[model samples]
Target: MLLLKFFGANVDWTSSIHPSAKIEYPWNLKIGPLSSLGEKSWIYAMAPITIGEKTCIGKEAYLITGSHNISSNNFELITRPINIGDCCWLTTGVTILPGVEIGNYSVIAANSTVTKSVDSWSVMGGNPAKFIKKREIKNA
Candidate 1:
């Protein structure tokens, strides 16, 4: 999709993104080699969203990198980067909040909401997602 790159997303030529995916502030987005953003996935990136090589973001997943200050009376906006390392998979309907780093080979299960950083090879699922187990890849 040369057209997609024109919109300011720094995606590798090998990467595949669905046409319906919404990437906000595309200049702040980067998807590495062979990574794919599935249909209707939304990346509301006011800051950077760096997706490492071979990552897969499943359908309807949301990666939000901006929020407003609740503690401040003025309610100023705040932005933070989201870093997803290589070979990670964020499954359908998963929501990753701002400032979260998902380590390499991690798997976020369907409908999970991640509020914190995930360790490498972790398998997490649930609201405010916690580590359920380690991801095991049996080279098939």
Candidate 2:
């Protein structure tokens, strides 16, 4: 992952990124200290993707920062930033869509698809992820 920094990715040296994780547009990617990207995860950073400190993205998670605008006759590509805040956990198979801001300390359940911004400390699940509960960090 150190090589990613050479390509303009703002990856912290303390971060643990699995070798199998695929990252596109490295220049647009930023990973904070002690964060992790699990094995086989894919990050399509057509815009910017910011993963905050101590966050964990589980295996096979997919983060997409671009999509086609079907409403346009030419099907133009639209790009947006994905911001995942501190201490968050995105479980296995979670799919985070474009322009979504997952707030600090949030938890995204397995296989959830987040289509919009999530509140801080929220536990969200299901497709187009809905708020299931608040994350209570003991002794935090």
Candidate 3:
């Protein structure tokens, strides 16, 4: 993060960004308020990655922005967008593949491979990641 500090990247408190984290194009990796990115996390950005307010990305989590073309016999590669909505928490070792959009107030369990879109207010786990349950908030 010395590069970010050197480049004058804006990081707000109530948020923790590890020193070992690698963010490709820190300018493009737009983080809203109260968000945190963990240590050794790699966020590869060809397309933009937008993390909404109060979100947390766990340690060593890989967010791949690039993908491959299935129709092409030569197996051409492509890039897909990733958008993580507000108040979400992504646990350690979670791999959020290309073109995945996770909605608000959701939690992805550790070591889960998210190949599909997860709905809002849901809890997901396992390989290829199925929905475990939904999150219910209590009104005060």
lDDT of each: 0.95, 0.97, 0.84
Task: Give the residue spans of candidate 1 off by over 4 A.
Answer: none
Cand. 2 TM to true fold: 0.97
Worst 10 residues of 2 by lDDT: 131-140
Sort by TM-score, top down from the best:
2, 1, 3
Q: Candidates' TM-scores?
A: 0.96, 0.97, 0.85
Steric clash pairs (candidate 3): 67-78
Order of candidate numbers by lDDT, starting with the best: 2, 1, 3
Those runs of model 3 whose alpha carbons end farther than 4 Å from true positions after fitting are 1-14, 70-74, 138-140
For model 3, residues 1-140, the per-residue Cα lDDT tens digits are: 44554544444545678878787756556667899899899888666777888999999998888878889999987988889999999999899998899999999999998999999999999999999999998999
Residue lDDT tens for model 1, 1-140: 68768988899999999999988899899999999999999999899999999999999999999999999999999999999999999999999999999999999999999999999999999998999999898987
**Candidate that scores best on lDDT:** 2
What local lDDT does model 1 show for residue 138?
A: 94
RMSD vs true structure, all candidates:
1.0, 1.1, 2.6
lDDT of candidate model 2 versus the reference: 0.97
Model 2 lDDT, residue 119, Cα? 95
Of models 1 and 2, which has the larger TM-score? Answer: 2
